[model samples]
Target: MKNRFRLNLFRFVLLLFVCVSCSQEYDKALEDALNLAGENRPELEKVLRHYHGDTLKLEAAKFLIRNMPGHYSFADTTEVKPYYDEVDSVLTTMKGCNVWTIRDSLVKIDNKYADLSPEWVEDIQIIKADFLIQNIDSAFVQWKKGAWARHLDFEQFCEYLLPYKAEELQPLDAWRTYLREFHPDHLDELRYCDQLKNSSLQSAITLNDNLWYYMRPEITEASQVRPIYRLSTRLRMPFGICADFTNMAISVFRSQGIPVALDFTPQWAFRSLGHTWNVVLVNNGKNVPFSGATSNPGQPHKPDERMAKVFRITYAVNPDLKRLSEIEAFVPSAFRYPFFKDVTEEYMDCEDVEIEVGDSLDGRYVYLTVFDNTEWKPVDFALIKGSKVVFRKVGMNSVYLPVCYEAGGQMKAIGHPFLHTYDKEVRPFIPDTSRRVTLRLLRKYPVLRHVQGVVMRLDSGEFHASNDARFREYEMLYRVTDCSVTGREVVLPDTLGAFRYWRYYQPKNGSYCNIADIRFYERATGKQCVGKIIGTDGCWEGNPGHTKDKAFDGDLLTFFDAPVSSGAWTGMDFGKPVDIGRFVFTGRGDGNSIDIGDWYELLYWKEGGWHSAGKRKAETVYLLYEDMPRGALYWLRDLSKGKEERIFSYEDGKQVWW
Candidate 1:
C-alpha cells in the first residue's frame, strides 16, 4: 500500500512537469498571450476562434507567447501593439498551410513554448520569413519549380526569406532593388560555375565568379565608402575590405534565394587581427565555406587559416546568446542574433581544451589567449565555475594561455603557454625544464600599427626581384601577420653569424610599417646588433619631394615615387662602401595605385657600371644573401612598367634610411 502511494505521487509530479513545460494551463497561456494584442485582441480572438479545434491556433498562440516578450524588451510594447494585425494576418493563413512546416520553423524560431517568460526564452526573433514572402508583395519569384528552391531543403529554404543584417550596412531591400534593375536576366548565369563538376557547388562558385572581378577591391578611406548601397555603388569606386566583401556576398547570395551566413572570429589565435567570411548552405547538406568577396568557392585563395572560434550570424533569436548580453559580455548589439551556431569544427580541427587554474571562483569570465608575437590576445572566453575553465572546440597546432579580461578591458594572463599539438595533445612548456631551449627572449617590441610585414636575414646584398626564391638570398625569418600599434616581438633564430644583417619587409599595402627600432641578439651570448640607418636610393631616382631618398629619411610619412615604366631604377651608395650584407626596402604607403615592381633586377656597380648580382621576380623588403664588395653602387631596376615602388636600405651595420 505504501509503494503504490509513492508511485502515484511520482506520476502526478511528472504530469505537472509536462503541463508546466507546455506553458502551464492552456486556457491561462491563451489568455495571457492574447492580452499582448491590446486593441487587436478582438481580431486575434476571431482568428483563434476560426481555428479553435485545430492545433494551428494553439501553435500560433504559443509562438506569440514565447517571443513577444523578447521583442518588447527592445522595442516599445505600446508602439508595436498595433502590429497585432500583422500577427493575426499571418495566423489566419496558417490554417491552410502545412502544420508541421510551421511547427518546424517555430521550433527554430523559439525553442521553448512552455515556461514562456524570459528565463529559457530571454531573446526572441520571430522570423516571419514565410509570411513575408507568401503574403507581402509578389516581387519575389515563385519558389516552386524555380532555380532557387529546386536544390534546397525546407530549412535551407528559410535562410533566403530570413534577411541578413550586419553592422550598419545598406538595407537589403535596396540591394534587391539594384539587383532587379541591373541584372534581371543574369540570375540563371549567377547560379553555376562551369569549372565545378558538382551541381551543388555551382551556386556558390557562380556567385563568386560573377561578382569577384566586377567589384574590384580598391583601398579607400573607411569613412567615405560604407553602407554600400548597391553593385552600382561599388562600381563607382570599386574597392572594399573584408567587411565590405562579406556584405556584398550576403547581399548577392540572399538576393538569389541562396542560404548564406556571415561567420567571423573576434580575434585570430596566431595573427593579431580578425577576419569575416561567408558560409553557404549548399544542396549537399554541408556548408561550403569561402572567404567571400575576395575569393570564390573552391579557389586557391580561400582562407585556410586555423580559426580559433567562429560565430555565425542568424536572423532568428538565440536564447543562450541573448542571455550573455544581460551578463555584460560586451557583444555588439548587431551581433545579438536571434541565434548563432559555432561551426568551427566544419572548417578546422577543434578540441575542448581545459586549463586548470588554482584560484577562487568569481563570476568574471576567463579567456583563452594565444601569443601573437608580443602579447597574449584573448581569442575565446567562458565563465569560471570553479578552479577549472574549459574552452570548447579550440583549433590545434598553436600556443594558448588562460587569461581574464579585467575591468577596463585589460587582459591579464593566468598561466604560461601550452602547445596544442596537431595530433590533439596538450603539452605545456615550462621554462625551467627544457633541452637547448630559447636562450633569451628577443625584440618583443612594436614596430608597426595594423600592418603585415616579413622579416629576413641577408642571404645576398644583391637587390633583385626573382621568381626563383633562391635567386635573391634573403632567408625568411618570420611573418608578422598582423603588426599592432603596441608593436611586436621579432622571434630570433636559434643560431646567428657573428656579423648578421636583418631587414623588415613591409608589403606594398597602404599602411606604413613604422619600425622604431630593430634589435637582434647573439643566440649564445645574448649580444645585441645595433643596426644604423645608412642612406636610400632616393638620390638616384626622379623628381624632388618624391625622390627615392625620402625612403631613407627615417620618416614613415615620406615615400618615393617614379613614372610607370620599365628600366626605372633607384639605389644607394653607402659612403666609402663597406661589405654590404643586407638592403632594407619599405613599400610606398601613401596610396594604393603607387606601382610596386613585380619583376626586377638587382645590380651592383663593380667595373664602373652596374653589374648583375641576380634577377628577382617579386619585390619585398629583402636582405640579399651574397655579400657585395664595398664602394660599389647598388640599384634596383624594374622589369615591368607597373607602379613605382618605395625603397629603403641599410648596409652592413648601418641603417638604410634612418
Candidate 2:
C-alpha cells in the first residue's frame, strides 16, 4: 500500500513536468497537429508521377547535358535584374519537389517556403547578353525552351550582348596612358591608356569555345569619360550597396561604350552582413568604386567619386597551397584603404618574398590602373624579377596580382581606403598568462568625451592574430573581467552601476573609412558579456566614404562607460594595487538617473561578497554596484538592498547598513 502511494506521487510529478514544458494542454495536442496538416499544401502527387518514367528521363538528360552550358533566353524588358521575378515563379512551382533535374545534372532543391538562388543563370555577363534565338553553344547559359527563348532573333541577341556599338568606341585609352603618366604620351589634363584599355589585355578575355567568353571588369576607363549618375541621399558607402553599385555601373557602361562584369564575393559588411561588389573594364581602363550603387549609410564610402584603387581582388599561386605566400606586392599607389598599410613588401625578408605553389583566392584578380611614377600616382604595369616585384621601366601602373596575408596570416581582402589594405589584417594581440597588458593611445582619438582605445594581450596563453583560428576579421571583442585568486570574481557586465561602455570612431581627415571593432572575451570561460553596442542596435562608428566627423551613420547603438559610484563605498578604491594590469570599461543600456559626470569605484573579491577594491576607505566609495538588471537599466539604487539612503552595501558579509 505504501509503495503504491509513492508511485502515485511520482506520476503526479511527471505529469506536472510535461505541463510546464508546453504552452497548450495535452488534451489539445492531437487536435492542433491535425489542423496544421490541413493548412495550404499544394498537391504534389502528379509532379511525382511526371518524373517516375525512367526511359523519358534518360533521353532528356542526354540532350540537356549536351546543350545546357550554352542555352540562354533573354528578357524583352530592361529591368536590370530582369530575370528575378520569372525565376522566382519557377522556384515557387518546384517547391513541391525536394529534388529537381535537368538532363544528367540534378540539384537538391528546397520547398517553395524557403529562399533560393536565382534559377536561370547566364555566367557570361560581361558585355550585354540577350537571347533573340535559343542556341546551345556557350558556357553559363541556362537551357531554356518553350516560350522562354522565343523572344529575340539571334542577330539582335548578339548585338545586344555585344554592349558597346562601333560609333561610341572612340577616344579610349586616355586613362590607360594616364595610368602610365611617364610613358611620354601622358596627356596634360585627364589620363589615358590605349593598349591596356581597348586591345587584348582588356578583362574581356576568351573562355570556352568562340561564342563563350567572360570579362572581370565592372568599371573601365572609357566609361568614366561620360557622365556618372547616382541616387543615394547620403554620401557614405554602405554594406548593401557594394553589389548594386557594381551592377549599376555595368549597366551604365554598356549603355555608353564600355562593357562590364560583376564580381561575386562572400565577405561581411561592418555590421557583419555578407556582401558583394563589381569590377568593370570600361573602354580599356579600370573604374574601382569607393561605394557601390546602393545607399549604405554608416559606411565610409563615396560611389560617385573615383576611388584611388582602380582594381582590387584576391589571387592564387601555381593553383596549389605550397608556396602561396611566395608572391608579394602592395598598393601600386596613394591612400587606398584607411589605416591602410600595404605591408606586403614591408614584411619582406628576401626568402619570405618567395612563392612555391598552391596558393589561390577567387578575389585574387588583377586591375590595370593608370600610372604616373613622376606624380606618384598610377602605372599600368609593374615588374617582377624572381622574388622581387618592382616598378621597373616606364609602364602603366598595373600588373598581375597575388593574395594578401597581412599580420602574417591568410585573410580575405575587403575594401578600405588606406595605404595598409595590402598588409596583413590588424587585431589586438592576446597574452598567454598575460597579467599586465597596457593600453596605448593612437596617433589621434575620437572627440567624444569618455571614448578610449584599448589593446589587450590575452593571458593563459600567448596571443597572436596568427595562432587564433577564431580571429576572422581585423578586430577583437573584449570585456574587462573582475575576477580574483580563485574564490569568486566580480564581473562588470555591459552594465556596472549605471556606467556604460563606449565605442571609438574614426579620426578626422582620414582618407578612407576606418572600420575596426575591439571586443572583450574570456578565454578561460567562453561567456560573452554580449554585444552592448549590438544590444542598443548601435551603428558601426567610424570614418565612412571619405567623409569625416560623422557618428552612428550605419546603424544606431548605445554603449556605456565605467562606474557611477555606490550609495556608500568610496573608500575601497584607494590604496589597493592587487594586480589589475588589464581592465575594460563596459557600457550598459539599462537604468536612469545616470548623471553625466557620475563615476564608479573598482571592486574586487573579499571574503564571500564583493567589496570595494579601487577605493581608499570601505564606507566612502563603492567600486561597483548594480545597473541594468536583465535588459532593464537599473542603478546603484537598485544594487542597494534597502531604500535609497539607508540601502544595502557589501560590508562584513551580510547585507547591512553602511
Error of 2 at 32 (Å): 58
> What is the TM-score of candidate 2?
0.24
Those runs of model 2 whose alpha carbons end farther than 4 Å from true positions after fitting are 1-241, 256-258, 261-658
lDDT per residue, candidate 1, 1-658, as tens digits? Answer: 9999999999999998998876666566467545655554565555445446756333543433333333322122333223333333443555445544433443432333223232121212322333323211221242333454445644444444333233232322345445534333444654365433234356666666666655445433232321333343333233445766775667666655556678877666544556777777666677666765567666543355556777776544465555655675454333344456677787787999887776664555676765443345666667766777777898887666676654455555676556677888877544232222111111112233233332221111123222222224544555544332221234343342222333343343322332322333434554433444322323223556655445455343355443322222233322221233223333333221112233455544332223576665532223232454433323444455422222112235432210
Alpha-carbon deviation at 324 in model 2, angstroms: 12
RMSD of each: 17.3, 29.2
**Native-vs-model 2 lDDT?**
0.24
Residues 1-658 of candidate 2: C-alpha lDDT, one tens digit per residue: 9999999999999998887765344224323322332321111122223335644332222222222222222322232232333334443454334222210011111222134332332212211212211111211131112111123233222322232111111111122112122111211111145333332113222110111111112322122211112211111112123443454433333332223344331211111122344333333233222223332212333332212232222211111111222233343222121111121121121111122122333323222222121111221222333333322221111111222334433322221111112232211111122232221111010111112221111111111121112223222223224211111122334422221232322212211112211232333353322322321111224213212112122111222211211110000111211221122221221112121223333222222222342322211112323321111101122132222121112222222211
TM values, all candidates? 0.53, 0.24
- The top-ranked prediction according to lDDT is 1
**Top TM-score prediction, candidate number:** 1
Off by over 4 Å in 1: 1-143, 164-178, 182-185, 189-200, 219-237, 301-304, 326-338, 362-365, 370-378, 383-386, 404-414, 428-658
Q: How does residue 261 of candidate 2 score in lDDT? A: 43
